[model samples]
Target: MTPHPAPQSRGVALFDLDGTLVDTTYLHTLAWWQALRRHGHTVPMVRIHRAIGMGSDRLLDAVLGPDRETGEDEALSDAHGTLYATWYDSLQPFEGAAALLRATAARGWRVVLASSASEEEVAAVRARLDADDVIDAATSSADADATKPAPDLVRAALDTVGAEPEEAVFVGDAVWDVEAAARAGVPCVGLLTGGTTRRELEDAGAVLVHDDPLDLLRHIDAGPLARPPAPGGTS
Candidate 1:
């Protein structure tokens, strides 16, 4: 019998789950709004939407003002978490989400999830995706000193797998994600599955953009996820 070839070992593939893999961007926006309202803060949904990819510690500062009372930070973050947890069961992965992950794994890439969310939140998202078998590692808020747009989480993800910036590419759907990838010196591939637009992502440093995970999966060969050139060789 002809022997099957070994799986092609590409570089690591780091992913941001919330809006990039699952359809939770708007849900998070609504949750943040409700949480803020419950705490007597009235942040607009638009502002909250833009802050979705930021960590809870940074969200308030981004949407609200730096002048906000520092003491209320934990309470506000707790409220948001409490409210967001209610919709956990309803969270769903985007079309071809699991397939995309599995396909990337099949290419022998070390797949890791990089999220600024709490451990529970990240677990919920992973459960929704239901593709943990293909996932090699994950780094949540607890694993990082800071969050997106800071490079902490991205660097943590890379450290989890002992990968270098050039040996991996980040896939995400928000400007913060792009910024984080850039700070980590890793190229970013943006997806519009989140509410972020192509122009915004591009301006933030995404090397390429796609409509969603499925779209990216379909174009992987010709897209940013394509295998890099061999050492000392040009593509």
Candidate 2:
């Protein structure tokens, strides 16, 4: 009988959709701010911006305090969603976001978008990304029991691609992303496009930081998404 070759090992590239790829950080911040105001809460935009990457519930907890009346949580989230939806048609992906996904796919990595956005929101943003050809899979808020800073979403994304933590790399633009990836046992690459400082992302456990998707693409070989060495070959 002829010998059979082993199956190829492929690494997974997990990416965050909002802010990391699409330029919706400020839009989210504004939406949340307006929602909070409508709910009689007056949180600062700076604080809301920093909390943009968190799930709606966590974001409310972080901004409105855990002691806040639970009765208004759902309403507040709905308000934000309504306000945010207004800009759906105008959403734009950061420069080189599609190229980065393509390049990573070309390098034999399975690219998966790990986003906390709802399915409808993910669809809208994916349309803006226009990189579905290279994306192997994508996870929405429904895929996980929890969200960023909790690791459930990251783990869900990993599961979607049948990837183990050690065989995956996550890329995002927030400290929450780094924290989530850390809890999921995957190294993360942070981007500055979402208004997060590099120091904050580094402190949260990002292995590397870049200015944005374009910057990361420019130095892809030097980051976590670099092609893995072949069997019995040097890196």
lDDT of 1 by residue, 1-235 (tens): 0012223453678999999999999988998899889888888899999888988878888888888888988888888789989999999899988998888877667788888888889988989899988787888888887877899989988787666787788999999999999999998999998889999999998999999999998988886566643333223
Q: What is the RMSD, in Å, between candidate 2 and the native fold over all Cα?
A: 5.0
* TM-score of every candidate: 0.93, 0.93
User: Which regions in candidate 2 have their CA more than 4 angstroms from the true location?
Assistant: 1-9, 228-235
* RMSD per model, one decimal: 4.9, 5.0
lDDT of 2 by residue, 86-147 (tens): 99999999999999999998887778899999888898999889988878788888888887
lDDT of predicted model 2: 0.87
Q: How close is candidate 1 to the true structure, as a TM-score?
A: 0.93
Which residue pairs collide in model 1, if any? none
For candidate 2, list the clashing residue pairs, or say none: none
lDDT of each: 0.84, 0.87
